[model samples]
Target: MGLFTRLDRASVLYNGMADRLGVGETQRIDQPAGAAAYRSALLRCSACAEAEACAGWQMEHARADAAPGYCRNRGALAALRVE
Candidate 1:
């Protein structure tokens, strides 16, 4: 499988958890600016106490935003689908 394909699968997992947990849209994180910021965020996020739950909400919000979304917390999760 490809890199994006892997991330997409991971994103789906988190999305499912978010649904089961009843997390809301207001919980989605903010977007990061560039590659470095995104990477830093990803590392920091990995250590978060709420990483699993937060990741779930992020995945859903990303899907709504037409993700492969970037953020200072979760990094990019998917590429925009092409026609």
Candidate 2:
């Protein structure tokens, strides 16, 4: 994919996964530390080898207690879920 396309896809996947785990909006992670984690999560998702699997997992789970094991942003997202 081109740069914009890749970023868009990653943003969608990142947000979708967050929603599944009740993490609300990515933009809402505005505490200095949270903002950093949010940025890292997007970057990680953009380069993730498991993007395809993540998309499938999001499709299968409308809402979930946690992120899939393969998700690179699992811990960051879980933190967001708690806050």
Candidate 3:
């Protein structure tokens, strides 16, 4: 894939996972720490190898309690979810 397409895929995965985990709302409530964690999660997503599977999974599920096992950002996303 081209550079832009690859970057877009990564962005989609990061944003989709963030939304699924309510990271934006969390960041709004806990600015510094939440934003830092979310950014770190996004960085991890950008380097992940499961983009195709991640996209398919995100499309199939509107929300999930935890990210798929193959996701590089799974731990970060799961931790960010509100209890």
Count of clashing pairs, candidate 3? 0
- The better candidate by lDDT, 2 or 3, is 2
- Candidate with top lDDT is 2
lDDT of each: 0.40, 0.81, 0.73
Angstrom error at residue 38, model 3: 4.3
Winner on lDDT between 1 and 2 is 2
TM-score of each: 0.34, 0.85, 0.71
Please provide, for model 3 over 1-83, each residue's C-alpha lDDT reduced to its tens digit, 9 standing for 90 to 100.
77667667777788887787666655533745766665666667777788878889989988777888898877766666667
- Comparing 1 with 3 on lDDT, the higher-scoring candidate is 3
State the TM-score for model 1. 0.34
lDDT per residue as tens, model 2, 7-66: 899999999988888876743376457777777778899998998999899889999998
Kindly indicate the candidate among 1 and 3 with the higher TM-score.
Answer: 3
Error of 1 at 21 (Å): 0.5
| Candidate number achieving the greatest TM-score relative to the actual structure | 2
